[model samples]
Target: EKHLVLLRDGRTLIGFLRSIDQFANLVLHQTVERIHVGKKYGDIPRGIFVVRGENVVLLGEIDLEKESDTPLQQVSIEEILEEQRVEQQAKQESEKLKVQALKERGLSVPRADTLDEY
Candidate 1:
């Protein structure tokens, strides 16, 4: 069956389910990484994927008929990558402003990189 798998790191993969284990590990054939930005999306072929159980965030069967009727438009890979880059830059700018505001109030924001120092 065709399935859509979302990983912990925010990757969406679509492929045919080939195998699975008790721990939720999966083997997907003819896989592709799907990237979406707003109403546009692009798929990059990944061939086969072996996903670890621990990284699995969500999994669901894909209805082929309804999949074709999605409101989203498919864009070229180059365009999608450019959009993704812009989106990430905007997010980073907002995050930096947030951290700046916190600092202005004498509130230090904990950095994710420093969390392991303890």
Candidate 2:
């Protein structure tokens, strides 16, 4: 059976009803978030309290959606080779920029003295 708890603040939490006492108190876990309480019930108190099943709005069983199990397309070898080539070109350009920046700072490397050798 579903469990329900009424906060003195007029909010209700719905879950698998666990247990209740003669004092109209309740204990429940796996609770859903709060629902509005009617002003007719007066202001809810600050402490936890049990709500009667008859008083509950009875939002039916929760439904969770399942994920699709479709497989992703396999990458081709040509695509992988092209990606590697692009990465290597980027690295070479970055090294060239670094050498140019060092030269501007008066920190020349002898090995990088000739653009043709680079």
User: Ten-residue segment with the worst summed lDDT in candidate 1?
Assistant: 109-118
- Model 1 scores a C-alpha lDDT of 0.97
Highest-scoring model, lDDT: 1
- Per residue, candidate 1 scores C-alpha lDDT tens digits across 1-118 of 9999999999999999999999999999999999999999999999999999999999999998898998999999999999999999999999999999999999998988778865
Per-prediction TM-score to the true structure, in the order listed = 0.95, 0.31
How does model 1 score by TM-score? 0.95
Error of 2 at 47 (Å): 73
Question: 16 in model 1: Cα distance from truth in Å?
Answer: 0.4
Which one wins on TM-score?
A: 1
Clashing pairs in 2: 2-17, 3-17, 8-44, 8-45
In TM-score terms, candidate 2 sits at 0.31
